[model samples]
Target: MRAMARALPSLLLRLLLTSTPGALGTNPGLVARITDKGLEYVAREGSVVLQRELLRITLPDFTGDFKIKPFGRGHFEFHSLSIHSCELRGSALTPLPGQGLSLTISDSFIRVQGEWKVRKAFVLLSPAADSKTRIQARLHGSFDVQVKGITISVNLVLGREPSGRPTVTAPGCSSHIRDVEVDISGDLGWLLNLFHNKIESRFRRVLESKICEMLQNSVTSDLQPYLQTLPVKTKIDSFAGIDYSLMEAPRATAQMLDVMFKGEIFNRDHYSPVSFLAPVMSLPEQYNRMVYFAISDYVFNTASMVYHEAGFLNFSITDDMVPPGSNIRLTTKSFRPFVPRLARLYPNMNLELQGAMASAPFLNFSPGNLSLTPLMEIEAFVLLPSSAKEPVFQLVVATNISAMLTFNTSKITGFLKPGKIQVELKESKVGVFNVELLEALLNYYILNTLYPKVNGKLAEGFPLPLLKDIRLYDPVLEIHKDFLFLGTNLQYVRA
Candidate 1:
């Protein structure tokens, strides 16, 4: 169209001259231009509005095409036309702006914004038909479009914006269901042998299951607010992110026979929330584990959970696995009785209930039960500074533990055991934990048995047969503590 209108100020001046930040945080200025209202995009079988008949392809030959109509005024006309762009040079493309990509366009639709590394720069439409030989690969991105807001950076590595949350096991799970269904058995070769074979060969090599479920429902709507900060009672009904980005369709034999993945993990406030919320459980492999697109090896994770419990429930694949590649193991099944009339009808006076019961197996990489939410004011002190003569006894305590960053922080540091005072926690600038090792963790937690508990009145360390009573095993009665922790949500919080 007049060469896309004189290449719209040379692609918004190459997105204002490649935007910047390029050290690693990689922003590269993502530039744009060619507005007048155009480019509305969408994938997975719907939405399209292009221009200049171009959405083409590149490399050994994957073939391509995308052209739209309606232009001038309200505006329209989009294209990506690629017959072959010299094998996508650097790889990954998107609505990268400041350097080039803001895309808003409307008629049909177009939104896909930026940042978080433009997530493989959107545009992953693969039906598969070009491979005379050309896989050296290198695409890089910035094929953006935005109308009202004015951004049109489109050179066409061809795109950006695209992007798994799977783990649902509720003892009985009751409320919260808007409509979700996924039931499958063995297809993508049994999910390429159950999430193996390098994550089902990188989810069919990214491209087309409606453009990887529209980038796994846009990374399951951006990780449902960090899975709503976990811990309520574990019933998270749904949460998605599965953009199998085309899934390398060389031939395509079978994939959706009800292979699960319907989608609905709503906005729960909680009643018993133990949500590993399953929707197709692939949340972009927790951020690009090659966008994990394992199409079908095993998809049947039925969950309804809500107390009335059991135990030994662990699925598989989160890493740490070694030998020949662990294809899902440890299957036990639990949670069946815990409706104490819904825990006495919602008894959450700032909740704590997890003191003791008998249910403790959970170990696959531990880190649970722990809790804390101190992004900035965490001071765990116990100073004894005054050492000149004696009476120096001080202790400082704090707790706001917003509940160990969403379920299982190494078993919540194993129930926060780091307190025991008598003296020398390394000479006390702030007695640094391990003073009598909190008396051997208070004899295995209030006397369950790590031994020890004598003459301080059935309590306080040193009992287990009085270690030959060498004057109560002297060495200057040592003890101390210093754990100034103010940690919260283990990383990332710009807002």
Candidate 2:
């Protein structure tokens, strides 16, 4: 008994997951939950700033091989025998190709103070340092430079390999640098300053090539691996689980990044066959960041199939269900109990109620009348004392179900209500007596037992997928021709 109790949830879970028409094989369903067709991830300026890592660079030593003779007095050859480098402190960046960015560096300077030699022609140099000859050359200044022509792009892919994670790939890109200017105050400012324009131009070309290379390498090599793997499954106790899968890679635009994915809220042990209807992405820009998803009939049908196979459609009315003051009616024609009450007259009689889905649920997403209808088969049987396992009397009824959808805050909620009820007497069997009033009892059982259960399960709608360190708010739903849209704003909070 204890072992059965422990295994009950697992059994229920296994039944909840079956197979769809297209997905009937092993490990069928997609592994990720897709919201708004996929993950419509938009990292604004704030997110970019918070996540940007620091950068550092080291330059090789420079050698001055040429000689400089000012006013034909004496010849001076300056040489740098040590290493020199500069650091780019911080940067402000924008998206898209051919955009502009600004970089600033404090305490930035280049110094090449070393030995110098001066040779005179007939010793006619006016200012000659023959006793002690030294070369003092230094150019130190803070820089506020602008870079342009930068282009960035990312391609996101999802799968389950070493782990269930999405991967991003970025190709190598380049840009041109212009408007390079630097201030200088050093000993060689007078003679060395002659080539200021030439120096700036050379630096611009080197800086542009270096920055582009760094950006491409970092995005493709470092950032790609970090974003490739993500935890996409949610655990709902030991019986149920919610899964998410990416339908395709994410595409980037001028303003935002768009991702496509699909999601499932079903049992852990059972699999439901589902067809993905890709939704159009028109992420409304009413908030800083938002996501939208369109719920389709496929999702509803998949949920229903999983529920049907989980044994939730079948129920029983035991002998203990008799009212305290009144006995259960033995005859189905009217509410008339047999003489001497049911315990003595029909001691071993019990009622068995069973329900099955005749067809998949139909979802119509019209303007105001977004309704879901499903057809089902319901059966009732009376177990006599002689036939302990089999039924003596049975009745089959067909029921038409209608459920209305409404919004409960960010989640979509549904209300279950039974519609037309059709009694199928051909498939129904009657033995000892015929009860005309059994139809009403069957209808009551369906509305109170089956339909409400379905509705309540649906009312516990799928929650919105969330990002790390971000709070989502005001999730809104919109219905379109191909798919449904779920939009919500994102707010970043400090942890």
Full-model lDDT for every candidate: 0.21, 0.45
User: Taking the tens digit of each residue's C-alpha lDDT, what string does model 1 give over 202-287?
Assistant: 22232212222332333344323333342222222232111112111111112110111222212233333233422222211122
TM-score of 1: 0.17
- 273: Cα error in model 2, Å: 4.7
Local distance difference test, candidate 1 = 0.21
Kindly list the per-residue Cα lDDT of model 2 for residues 108-226, writing each as its tens digit.
Answer: 23222233333433323235654534443333322222333222223222223333345643343444543555433344444444544654565566555555565556656664554
What lDDT score goes with residue 134 in model 2?
Answer: 41
> How big is the positional error of residue 257 in model 1, measured in Å on the Cα after superposition?
37
Specify the highest-lDDT model's number.
2
TM-score of each: 0.17, 0.59
Model 2, residue 195: distance off in Å is 4.0
Worst 10 residues of 1 by lDDT: 461-470
